[model samples]
Target: MSDSPHSTDGDTSRATLARVAEQAAVSMSTVSKVLNGRPGVAAETRARVETLLSEVGYTRRGAVVPGAPLIEIVFSELDNEWAMELIRGAGATAKLNGMGLIVTQSGTRHAPDPEWIDEVISRQPFGIILVMSDLPPANKDRLRRLQIPFVLVDPSGNPAPDVPSVAAANWDGGLQATNHLIALGHRRIGVIAGPHDVMCARARVSGYRAALESAGLPVDDDLVQPGDFHIEGGLVGGTALLESRDRPTAVFATNDLQAIGVYQAARALNLRVPEDVSIVGFDDLQFSNFSSPPLTTVHNPLYEMAREAARILLDIRAGSPVGTGRRELGTSLVVRESSVGPA
Candidate 1:
């Protein structure tokens, strides 16, 4: 005999289906048949079950009930094209599996509110994906008690050893971007780095320093300007580097938005890209391709990473074993018109 559709996949035993069955005052098997569109049930009984299912917003594992649970996507902020790409990928995957994806913001805080967690527990979602944010330990425990699976997408900080996370190869990306600039005969290289608190940013900058060290060049603290990973941060950070008496011939903006900001700053100083200054960036956001001179960037594969994360959650929901560890996608340098040798 096949597994019963009435049975759920997780420890979430208090399913909406159970309540619907209790309210309809019918056998769970009868309700299951109606829910799955299986025949051989009385028309009156089926109608009752359908009505109760609607009233309760519940769907059994194989039920064709509407308003089924969604896969939640929690984002730190939805202010960038890269964030949209993550949504597009996860949404596509959820749709393919006959599920819908819902996006929620983390608000001004990097993590969502406790009330938000209460709401999520009430909804009893299939799973959740956290993008560029960390979950509080208490919330993590609550989710575990509720048997809700969650994965992190490019986690913003250092996650615990047991957390499941998907991300791009930040270290290699940083190494390769700086290596490309080095190959172009640009010795005075500067870096407009992101906040030190972010794990990816830290890894990228570390790779930059490693590359310079490997080439027998001294790592200069004066050449590294730390900023938030935004266009405005890039503008301020890039300006500071550019105004220095010993300004670098080539500079790397750790993220693409900052790269665009660097471009704006370059224009302000009457400097031409690939001529008076060279720039490289990371994340390869769609707009990078259409920028003034096109960006030389490290492709971070945000969409693919998000899609894989969704797949992992699906497997977990299906009671399949997904390893608990950081999963890293590869990154590579894409050369464009914005980078060249020192003038």
Candidate 2:
């Protein structure tokens, strides 16, 4: 029943937990936990109560502010060019800000294991950035209950409605890639639609279809094949497209990796690039420049996207304004030697 020191600012009466609770619009138990700097309350909620106490010239009995004060970056795997680029961007931002970053791989693409989620909670990071995947609702709820902020970078599927995300303009990139081929006077264009379940893949396909319709061309079923955004899918899908009797003159693979595999398929069929068949790919990866005759592709800045995601996550932690739940960087088309008028 010890009353804290009195406030000399206008009112000389000591502050009471009841008054704090009433002013904060929270229960007595919540005020108690906040004053004790307990982990049960939300960050924003805790910030609000702390602000109110400071304004009223009231000091908590023994509370220092509670913040885990670490940033974490989670990924499915960290073994690819794109992944390396993402790490560079995020790491650079963290270094400049004098913040330490914790990197972890979930060891699975579809989702992180339950133990991983538990580990995240135990660490209690200030913010988290999930690359190439989104947390399940249950996992997200756990984070929410703990009041930890998180964002997704290039999630395989659409993020939760309230979740924050950063991504590239997959649809626009797709449209531009297709349009570039069409402008080259290639009427019969083929496309390798990426994995069926990937949101970006579906978007690219839609863009390809839209571009074809805009050019008054039909989207032929035989011309659109499935891809997995990897070499194997490209090799298999590309082979099927090239073997068709009514094969397209040009093909747009969902990504550069797949496009290179397509080149292997074409070479097996004795089809020389550009002279016999034109190709356009997405993701202007470093390897794209060295592919035979080079590659005409869309440049998706994965690094910049990662940097921005880190910046945005920090901004969220600071309680600043984020324009939208989702942010998408623009993409550009790099016309290289791999594309030309079809023979």
Candidate 3:
């Protein structure tokens, strides 16, 4: 093999596998494995070497060098059931396409680390998928500068025109849930919306208003409460709604987790679901059907959404057009024991 470093210019010499190995604190053979896109190198080690190379300004000289197409998926958190389903779907699609999926959690922060992004780009991944909520402006700018193919999944706010995305029909799901209650003669409907800034939350709220408007019912501002998309937040919000003198006959929660919290709130207030009050939730997570009364919820295809996003990234890498900018899948309501006519 050629170990001699090539001279790039008057004063700088081209980086070699040995130099990268030394800088990354690994054996030269390991560096060669990564440089030539060979297998056997651990994911974390590969990322380290890739980051080192970029930090030292090393550029590989070749065309279409082949192996597994490394793709990094950055997520805001991994604690949620929906997020786990999304990961599983994306991972399966990546495997089918002969690509490797690297999942990294960004703590509770909104944006990913700039160094991490540099590492990902240095590895020359086939593509990237950002499954995050409200990525900061600085991170967006950095991503734009990388000039690599990428797609966003569940972006919480407006995204740059260049970045493509795949999302669910959240507004329609919300509208459907609200309309279902309205049709059951529930005029005093309360809303337990998720985080105020989250895109899904905002869309669901919009749908709720639309349903009320269609039914000629005035939107009651006092009946609506914001939750942090967590069970505890739901419990607090649900309790407040239940304690009101003019309690709503039915309630619509933005997610299954929140809906579960509402169940607790109902028990605390000595109210039986669908008998004294009705409840409907979104995102039919695994446990939704097993809830005390079996939640009536809108089914969000989390796994399908993830798979579609991965497929789109693969297409982009292959230089094939994956249709237009953004793609949105539909949602449907699942009737269960949690909802019925207003009492």
lDDT for each residue of candidate 3 in 1-343, tens digit (9 for 90 to 100)? 2331322342232345567688789997886565555667776787777666555555423211221266677887777787788889888998998777888776343567545654564465666778864455544543333335667786453444556778889899999999999988899999998886687788998999999999999998998998887889779989999999999989999888999999999999999998988999999998999998999999998899889988887776566877547777899999999999976
Residue 213 of model 1, lDDT score: 95
Go through the candidates in order and give each one's C-alpha lDDT. Answer: 0.79, 0.79, 0.76
**Which residue runs does candidate 2 get wrong by more than 4 Å?**
1-69
State the lDDT of candidate 2 residue by residue for 234-261, as single tens digits: 8999999999999899999989989998
Q: What TM-score does model 2 achieve against the real structure?
A: 0.79
**Which residue runs does candidate 1 get wrong by more than 4 Å?**
1-69, 155-157
TM of each candidate vs. truth: 0.79, 0.79, 0.78
* TM-score for predicted model 3 compared with the true structure: 0.78
Instruction: Itemize residue pairs with steric clashes in candidate 1.
Output: none
Query: Per-residue lDDT of 184-205 in model 1, one digit per residue for the tens?
Result: 9989898988887788888889
Clashing pairs in 3: none
User: Model 2's lDDT to the true fold?
Assistant: 0.79
